[model samples]
Target: MKKFVLKPKIYFNEGSMEFLKEIKGSCAFIVSDSVMETLGYLQKTIDYLNETGIESAVFKEVRPDPDVKVIAEGMKKYLETQADTIVALGGGSTIDAAKGIIYSLWQFRKAAGEEFKKPLFIAIPSTSGTGSEVTNFSVITAEGEKVCIVDEWMAPDIAILDSTCIQHVPQSVVADTGIDALVHAIEAYVSTEATHCTDALAEKAVQLIFENLKALYNDASNSCARERIQNASCIAGMAFTNAGLGINHSLAHALGGTFHISHGRSNALLLSAVVEYNANLNSNDSRYASEKYARLAAVLQLPARTYREGTINFMQAVKDLLKSLGIPNRVRELGIDKSKFENKVETMVELALHDRCTPTNPRLPSREDLVGIYQKVF
Candidate 1:
């Protein structure tokens, strides 16, 4: 049986952060990062929960790429506070760290055969990317490798998309995270496991990204653009969580983890090459991916009279979008020395080949295929 999980009760629109006032729990454990603390987002969340008379214990230890140690540390604090709820209030990393802590707690209690009441999990994203708030996937680093953990119960019970939380975000962050959402939509649309249901969500997400990402990047204060991009991110997350992702994500996880690159920027750099690789236009074969990509191009109302033209148009549109956003089009732009990147090639390739996202790739890539793409990006 194939099951599509759309579990989160998402709250969006103006003043949606007040949903926290409806939170029911003795104490809400908030998982966030230093950035959120500095921006007073952490305080904003606490205040909302406080309105309901719920206590708060803040764990502001999450980092860019949440590692296993920090999750353990957060769990220790979670247990100490005896929090009945968990409010993940930040970007993807903070949300993933919160999910990890909750997952660990579940496993520990199950192993110990102790009765445990599952905490109510709520996610408040401070950025419009990753869709960690709605998806059952979480990435945590262990031993310097990015590991994606997928579980039905790992999805947040509630997702709040409050514009208040995302106001005046930096342009660089807007570009990076917005592009990640675009990648999510594109990858899911062409994933081998994609169903009609997922296609609908992914298509709408693609349209939204194309329409609003540039506007948001140019003017972070554009409330309409901001809300739409956030919606697009969540929609794309819903799409991929149900449809599964592909080699782009696999390669990105490996590349980012291996080099300490920002996840969104890493995905951004690899996107064009991945599209070309998957489309395989040079092979002159009418591939499934080409058709899927063509469908998206058609949705964007690009001049795609045929699948081939559609594929080419799609690739070019993506490149143009990246250029418009000021995202680096080549891996070399990140300043990693050529020799060092080449040296790590084998390690990255192996990790990518074995990544959870690879198997669902429309075209199963071999070592040579992966190597060529990596070198092309360089």
Candidate 2:
């Protein structure tokens, strides 16, 4: 059996903020980060929610890679306020923090023999990556490793994508997050677990991103680019959240938790190499893998005459995109010594093999294969 999970209420277009008035609650618990608050986004969301006559309070404790301790602290605040609803206002990390808070709350209540009540939740994305607003997956770091919490019931009731919120995102963030969306689409489409619905979402997302990411990177004022990227991010999120991701994400997760590298940036740096390595795993499967890569190359208008040419073009395009975006191209460029990476490759392999995202990878990498991919990227 196949199941597709998405937000119950999705509002898009000009002045979607009007949906705020329809919120059915007395108090709202907002989860956000300092960046969004500093950009005045959190305030804007609070003001709008307040206009709906709902008293609102914010838990601005969400960090880049939401840690278990941070979530626990937020849950403490949530329980204290007795808020009936959660309004997550920011990127994936902030929305994910809200997920952790709600789940922990239910678990805590259940432990005390109290019935679990679902919170009326709304997610408003400030950035175009992460699609956390629409997905049921929540990622949190525990014991210096990133862990994914999956449950269909955790899907938000509503997802609000406002292009205006993306204006404040920095250029580097745009590049990293945009690449994150691209990686999500490609990985999902190529995933062994992919379904028809996810494939459609992923393909459209890939097309949208290849067309608009550069424009958004070059000019934030371009609303057309902003809207496309935002829409693509959500579509990619929906795809990967259902079909799951692959080695690129698994490796990125390890790097994020271990070294504090930004999740999207880590993914951006590693995606091309992982894709190439996976495609090279078997000659018979080569054409199948190369076809999607060739399509990617064509979408970006790179040079590609054959499957081999397509693979090379796709790799080059990804590397060029990362360089143009001012992101470091390799783990070594991020200041980690190459030797450290070589020594840690085994551990990374073990962790990645067990990652929830790994089973769906087009290439089911063995420990040695993971090491080889890491070494090449390193």
What overall lDDT goes with each candidate model?
0.92, 0.84
lDDT of 1 by residue, 1-378 (tens): 555779999999868989999988889999998888888878888998999999999999899999999999998999899899999999999999999999988899999998777799999999998999999999999999999999888999999999778886899999999989999999998988898989999999999999999998988789999999999999999999998999899999999998899899999999999999999977866589998999999999998898899999999999999999999878889899999999999999999999889988999899999999899998
lDDT for model 2: 0.84
* Top model number, lDDT: 1
In candidate 2, which residue ranges exceed 4 Å CA deviation? 111-113, 285-288, 295-309
Worst 10-residue lDDT window, candidate 2 = 281-290
Tens digit of per-residue lDDT, candidate 2, span 1-378: 767766558887546766887787889999988888888878877887788888988899888888899998998898888888899988889999898889888888889999978889898988898988888889999988999888777789998888888887889899989999989999988887788899889979988987889888999999999999999999998998888888898888877777688989889878878988767834766466677677667766777787778778887777776777787867887888877777777777788888888888887788888777777766
TM-score of 1: 0.98
- The weakest ten consecutive residues by lDDT in model 1 span 278-287
In candidate 1, list every pair of residues with a backbone clash.
Answer: none
TM-score of each: 0.98, 0.93
